[model samples]
Target: MTGKSRAPNLMVFGVLLCLGLLFLVLPAYHAGNLARIMVLAVYAMGYNLLFGYTGLLSLGHAMFFAAGMYGLGLSMTGWGLSPVPAFAVGVGAATLASAIIGFLALRTRGVAFMIVTLMFAQAGYLVILYFGAYTRGDEGFVIQQADRMIAGIDLSGDAARYFTAFILFAVCFLGLAWLVRAPFGRTLIAIRENEERAQMLGYDTTMYKLRAMIVSGAISGAAGAGYALLFGYVGATFATVQYSIFPLLWVLLGGAGTLIGPLVGVFFMFYLIDISSAVTSAYMLIAGLALVLLTLFAPQGFAGELRKRVFAWLP
Candidate 1:
């Protein structure tokens, strides 16, 4: 609608073009790394919809992500479903899980709400881990060899798998870009700014929040499915609290609420980890130190601070 609002979309196009070119020029091994970065970006954007727009800070996003990953894996390995159907099964399970959690947690507010979500997510995580027969516990389960292919496309190939991730990321980027410009997205922002005021104005704040949670969960779930499909592995790590912090780190580093923030955040951290891993096994220590410095200096996040100082004139 305005120059300020359109800036993010323009940035998205530029970034995606750069990513495409990077994949084209880089070796397949490196390109696959970029593809994982794309999936992580999708995860961060989904979380941003709730944290950046609706002002909901959830620490249990791993529950939703794990739902999708395990859902797809189990569907294919145990239920004998094809790749596409298994993906849908994973997404649906995540959406439903998020809805249930949102419905129950919305009863509280602020700190209480955050704790409620964390508890629920933790309990679910434990259940998934203990039920080794279904999820194979920490070892995880892989998709059946027969169910790995979709129609004529051989997803076993790294190139095809990376392309699949690219397409999913591109479609999601476009969809989320359009969403933030729509009326529904605007309402989430309004709720975020002042929930009580929105309620006074006759908007159902709870319903809007629930919808945002479901949407966020579904998107994160889809990313999880893509991840399992790409790597052919679904493990307990994806469901842990440690993993949930990753998207938060990405969003804060790149700037929450900005459409391109997740992309920048993912690229920076992904490369940071990738490069650091070659030299030392303690790469996470390096990552943690960087995050600490970012917290001290750029607390508003890279994208948020950029807009405040440089792009203040933009929408």
Candidate 2:
């Protein structure tokens, strides 16, 4: 924010930009899958904004993600909107949904909060099920784009979509890092550390938590939109609890409060699953077992454990 900090910020941005460009050189198969992993990482970071930093464990982020995917899918397929506007609508819908659900969930805390969010998320999934005819029922809406909606660049192709996702992930990663270092973000951290103390110190803990939820929800939504566009489909499965828990696992495994931890977690878990699949039919079951073992052995998480033992100065 200050002139003295501009150089560091620029350098960080440059590093992120360079990292994004690296994807262009990756093999197509790796690039596409890595891009998807980056999207999931983004979603994890968004969840970390609240759950990790604000100490609010939400089980309903699927609600926001599903909103974004469905919104974009419907906009592009049913409404015939261009990519840009359709994506905007998707993000907006997720924002609206998060705001409404977060407002209600924030009224409770601990397990109560978690339950409320889950209930709302499940309700949203049911709505999608009920309106299956419009949303293509359980099969979902297939998105097909014939026009370039973003600056005349066609993002329908796999390579283009991968690059687009890289750009989004890079921007989000840096932006989220910046946000966590800001004053507002510090206040959220304070709330996480101790809500009573933060409130006593004149900070509006409730308001801060809500703000974090809004931002987190928006990022989650954006990730969802990017996934739908990249994959060219939006299904009700995106809204289910099965999907919601992935981000939680990612954040926890990565070291919930660490900036780049989510990225590491996504990379590790995604590839781990891939590797496990070649050897076993029940890949998820084995992965789950591995996770249980890892969690038990290293309670602080992968990044956290690394920081504690090797990199004491990790951010």
Candidate 3:
């Protein structure tokens, strides 16, 4: 690859290295926080693949997320499967769900698409509630610490959990960075910019979008599965609309279509709430104000703005 093509890979590696190093210095509390941030960053990155790159707006991603979570949770808790296999099942469930949803929802465009997704997600949430006998309803069941171990390593420990989250984030980050630089990624971008033109160019736009949904859902599902496995709890709350919106906020704030935007947005939002909550009960107000200012000043998002002004080479 040319130097220009190599830049994104180098940047991704550097970010992963820095994240790995940060664990050594971070306090246990902050380390735990970072772990959560990393997991959520994975979710935002998945959202970016569909919304940012493909220009498909989904308001019901929580169903796929919850699919992965409940897939893994129920597998281990009910069927007595191992963590690795359960995680795979969760990702698979998400992939399948996305494929089905994409086929149906992709038929509609714009606001109709968003509404369809939201309706599907709400239906999924209700299903979880209806099957309370297995899902445990709102009061989620906890995965015992003993079941959280992998190959004799205890993931419940601070260092182990942090490193695991870091590894998961790094893999997804680098993979996406590489993907967006690939030909398929370029096609998605083309479709995003102008679907009709892409179709005139002989591209199967619908197929590409369906594929994007599958990939996006798989990644989001992985994040959800990781969160449940690492944190040891899966609940109906994740299936709620708020969880779906969180990824959108992160992607928009970080810079949609930018490789590193998801992580930046997740880190920023997580700390914004963390710091604001300590000061007052009106944390949501503070967050809203911050978001408003960000939208007014940096319409393209934090990383998006930086890419526009400072780093044209940023992937």
Candidate 4:
């Protein structure tokens, strides 16, 4: 095709994508599903920042996620704070908590680091589970005011919440994209490629790792806040091993190193689960099999494979 023809095609594609997004955000689409997908995408993106960009694998991301949820839950219920400020407080709390955890975990490498993080997350989960009074144990906290107005906008309406989430997702993704292109991001890549060499070159690998963890945690926390608002509840289930593993699956299945890959993976996995749940009582089994097949057959993920095909077609 001529360059002129290609330009129009590209414009049409962009317009279609925007329209599709608008359709997804429509109130008739069901707020629960949209919010679930958006929050999960945000969570997956946070995990991708560390695993994809920094080459650090974490198996305890649920800890940060839970931290955010509980932070928002407690603030709103306990202190009667508004949702927006509560979310901000939750993000700060989660970031600080992750920073401390990352500080200790960064001292180790490889599987040890993964284990330490997992253990920490599990410990957190157990604490919430056992503390029935504070966390309401397994009963969970019902968000009675999830529909409350913030900045003169009611969150109870599906359209409003969907747009709010979409805006937040776009902002976070753009900020992350900018961050990965900055000098600090380059340093992170350097550390990921060769920590020892980076250290020898006078780079502070620990600080870099901690900073990455903080950013990842903060973003994940915000996602958690969104999750709570959408679901109108917070439960111990949010802090499960499954939650942590899901993000890893998203990163791996979407093409870990690419920004769009995780988002693509989120859509694929969520839809897969949605379909599987409709077909069988054992949704986990179906989802697990799908993940295994994707990992084995498409190691570079859907986005990576698509990129290869596109390049081949171009040539």
Per-candidate local distance difference test? 0.87, 0.84, 0.94, 0.81
Spell out the clash pairs found in candidate 1.
Answer: 4-314, 4-315
Model 3: runs farther than 4 Å from truth? Answer: 1-3
If both were scored by lDDT, which would come out higher, candidate 1 or candidate 3? Answer: 3
Best by TM-score: 3
Evaluated against the true structure, the overall lDDT of model 1 is 0.87
Q: Could you estimate the TM-score for every candidate? A: 0.95, 0.92, 0.98, 0.89
The sequence of per-residue lDDT tens digits that candidate 4 reaches over residues 1-315 is: 577546534543453366347646556654556556767888898998899889999999998998999999889988989888999888988898899999999999999999999999999999998887888977898888543568877776777767777766777776776687689888888988999999999998888899999999999988888788766789999898988998999988987866667777887888888888899988889778877898789887876787676532210
Q: How close is candidate 4 to the true structure, as a TM-score?
A: 0.89
Error of 4 at 261 (Å): 1.4
Which scores greater on TM-score, model 1 or model 3?
Answer: 3
> Local error of candidate 1 at 69, Å?
0.7
Which candidate leads in lDDT? 3
- TM-score-wise, the better of 1 and 4 is 1
TM-score of 2: 0.92
109-148: candidate 2 lDDT, tens digit per residue: 9999988999999999999999988886678867766543
Local error of candidate 2 at residue 298 (angstroms): 1.9
Clashing pairs in 2: 132-137
**How many backbone collisions does model 3 have?**
0
Q: What residue runs in model 1 are displaced by over 4 Å at the alpha carbon?
A: 1-6, 144-146, 313-315
